[model samples]
Target: MPRFPEVAESSVGLSDAVFSRLVARARERGGKVYPLHVGDTYLDPYEGARAEAIRSVDHQRLHNYSPVQGEPALLDAILAHVDRRSGAALDRELVQVVSGATAGIAVVVDSLLSPGDELLLLSPFWPLVRGTTQRRGARAIEVPFWDRLESMGDAAAVEAYLESFVTPRTSAIYVNTPHNPTGHILAARHLDAIASVAERHGLWVISDEVYEELWFDEEPASAWMHPRLRSRSVVVHSVSKAYGLAGARVGFVHGPATAMQAIRGVQTFVTYCAPRPFQLAAAKVLTEGRGWIASTRAHYRELAHRAADALDVPRPPGGTFLFVDTRGRRRDGESAFAFLERCVDRGVLLTPGTASGKDFEDWVRLCFTTLPPDDLHEALARLRQVLDDR
Candidate 1:
């Protein structure tokens, strides 16, 4: 077997360890697996968007490589979409399309973080955030955003608490609004406070806004758009969730020209450009489909409430996933791993909290968007049975 580096060997494994066992059991029983453990939508792409991709492929757009920055039409459409949706004035020079938000984030971390540097990450993060930082020979120092949200309720207090976590080696701050796992959407005012702290500390900010369009009751905001933070911030966005186009692998990052210039070279070495037709298709979705996204937001909001009420947990503020405490499900002398094993045995699959963060070992994250109402409700009901038995 081939060996790996010390860092690679030491890094946490992100596999849904329990889900694999669940898949095995499903095969053994020849029954449908209740899939509530993924962040993808089961819905089809909008007709207009699908047709655009087909049209491009039919005409052979996929055969050509795109500009290193982005397809011009796609970049223009992104600028317009961001301007209309977020009210941010951005110049064309500041934007560059990469693969997906995941790759865009990797590009940002690779560009900004250096060896022996530290990145301050809001904790219980997307988990891959750690790999992105560590792979660059940098460090991701996770600060618990939810713990701070609870202990320091005020925006100013939360900002100060975040500052306390910083060290001299810190190079940047990575934050996600409508955060994955917790679904905690940072308020505009809270984001402003974070921006202020970043400005004062002379920190670059990488804002993950992939879930920006999924907010339930609140208007979404990003740290990159704040007047104080704009010059030092990069925002990563994608069409995966809002437009049901994860397969397209189209995402972009926008920042001041100074940072974009640096990131462009790195992106060239890494992903070069997103698939040409995917970029054009995403542009079509952005330019042609706003009603679809608005309705999706409404549907997820209602479903979030339904799931939360059924699980007896608080409603997720945004995003398609929900992190629920499964501590109560443990039986005598059983660990959370054991609880999760039992859940799989009962035919319901969840991402065990171990994969996300050590601090969340007693929790499980559910993705409610992939299943229809009936399936989701059935899955949750099965989860309740597993939790209640013994």
Candidate 2:
């Protein structure tokens, strides 16, 4: 039905450049624009885990392809890391390394979803996931849940709310915590609710644990560790957010052996293998980066408080961002894009809330960890002015 040059219908209208215009406008303003729109940290990774520390002299054939499952050392490190955290040992056959969580999630969706299948996304989610499902010709059903957690009543209410979105086409539910946009960690009751729904409907659970090491208070339990969800869940982990090694692009996935077999088969054609040298570096980081994580967590926690104070929002308990409701701050007749432009005029850029979910058009996501303390303070000051209509 399509012409030669036409792209697939599923790929059309996908978010390719949601922030390009704002970025270009920020550049035109030409004065110390702080990019708080990105989900990253200003800190460098641990010394032993840096790419420069992994040398060809130390690692034979460092540039060559790693085994699709992962480098043996990295695999062992991941297994040990899981054991230490979850108190359960993972069989090596259950793990497969991929380019990053982004690619890793894509591979899982590709393996689990068929055309027209539905994946329930907890709303105000990481922005790219909707597009990830769309590219697979699957529907991403956004349930407005995260931002409303405090007012959503009990765990029974949460379960009912999520269940309302499930249909015969529903095949999976993707859960992330210390969640993106909002920093809410799902509590035990919340996890129980999710597991109950998955069990009732026979849905696969996709646990996103990229921020597993970035919580502010006590570490939240991994969602995949729920006994009922364990068999059907595939958990994805990354050193990118935890170790400030986003450029390294290394992450791993593990689940039950049966699900892993499908994931491993799909991974072979997706990325073949993660970058070999970085896999070695990631292994070192996983095995030895606890102190680094502790310090960075303290640093980010401080920044979260500072940013929240400046913006007059509650401090995020975990993760790097604050999802702010800008409805009350916007001028009469002003659009969300116009509100963002005012911030850009002040030489600060934040992500539009619409990027996270369709229901969040008047909200915005600000990443407190993207800039160093001084720059972030300055950016928050400028952003505060816009929010205050100064």
Candidate 3:
């Protein structure tokens, strides 16, 4: 028998401990399971999404492969939304849709990096960022966020890292604002500093702004608006979080015209195009569903606050997760995985920190976005009991 080499070894190794275990245990536990491990919104989908899907199927355009870059209507909608949000005159030529942000990231990595090139990564990251880049034979040189921040901000460390690590072999730097796993919104000064580093080093910035809409207080600053960084950056965003459309698998990559063209080239060999029906649905949400989007954001904000209050854990600035210090909460100094197992026994499934990176071994992420208010409250109660008892 012949064995084929794996195309995504690094990516496949970084298991999503919380999600996989929860699925198995939920099946075993049956009705007693209270799933708080997953980050999906328990909220209903936007009404416009449903109506638009019906309209799209009726129009027959949804049956065809969308324009190679994206369906024209969807591109226009993305451009209009960006213009309204950033006051920047974004052209439709700069937008390319993908299956989701993950696909967009893949295309960017493949288009930019050669094997053995180094990609500067900001950690603790989405894990897949490092995994995917590494799978392409690139090294992920990480600069830790909080440690670098000290009291200043992560931008300073970013600047320092670029100066020290960047070389001709360095191809790109990944930045995630309103970051996952840890919700650190990039500061304006940090972004400015990062832009200077990118300009000096001629490094590409792959900014994942998937959680840009989930801010609690202030609106997030767009790294795309930075003059020095605009032309060198690829901004990847998803409608999954904002529109409750994760299953739809819709996202877009907007950047300099040259890289946008390159992303299209990469997508041609990949998924080819975003699903036509989902793009049509996303277009409607971007154009005509501001009120519904606002309502959803407000609901998420309330849920974050409520869950934080119940857990008595300070909430991060923004994003769907509540990262908790689970250390010293279990007997015999149990590992995060063990603590997770105990919680599962009590019917609350949570994401263990080890999945994010090795540095977060004692931490665990509580997904507050899904589960109703009362259900979340009960889960928190059960979690507290499990922790206290242990």
Q: How far is 181's C-alpha from truth in model 1 (Å)?
A: 1.0
- The TM-score obtained by model 1 is 0.91
Model 2 Cα lDDT, one tens digit per residue, 36-108:
9989988889999997899999988999999999999999999999998887789889999989999999999
Candidates' C-alpha lDDT: 0.81, 0.91, 0.78
Q: What lDDT tens digits, residue by residue, belong to model 3 across residues 1-390?
A: 224665444455554343686567657876677777777888867887763454643667657798878878788888888888777777777788999888889888988888889998876777567767767778888765543454654666557755676777887888888877766677777788778888887888998878878888888767667777788889998988878888788899888887888888999999998888888888888898888878888888888888777777776678888877776667786767777777887888887775566677787787788888888888988987886785
Off by over 4 Å in 3: 1-31, 51-53, 146-158, 161-168
Better of 1 and 2 by TM-score: 2
Q: Per-residue lDDT for 38-125 in model 1, tens only?
A: 7888787777777444564365556589999998989889989999878987888888999998888989888988888999877777
Candidate that would win on TM-score: 2
TM-score-wise, the better of 1 and 3 is 1
Model 1 spans > 4 angstroms off = 1-30, 51-53, 56-60
Residue range with the least summed lDDT across 10 consecutive positions in model 3 = 1-10
Q: Tell me the lDDT of model 1 at 61.
A: 59
Query: Can you list the residue pairs that collide in candidate 2?
Result: none
lDDT of 1: 0.81
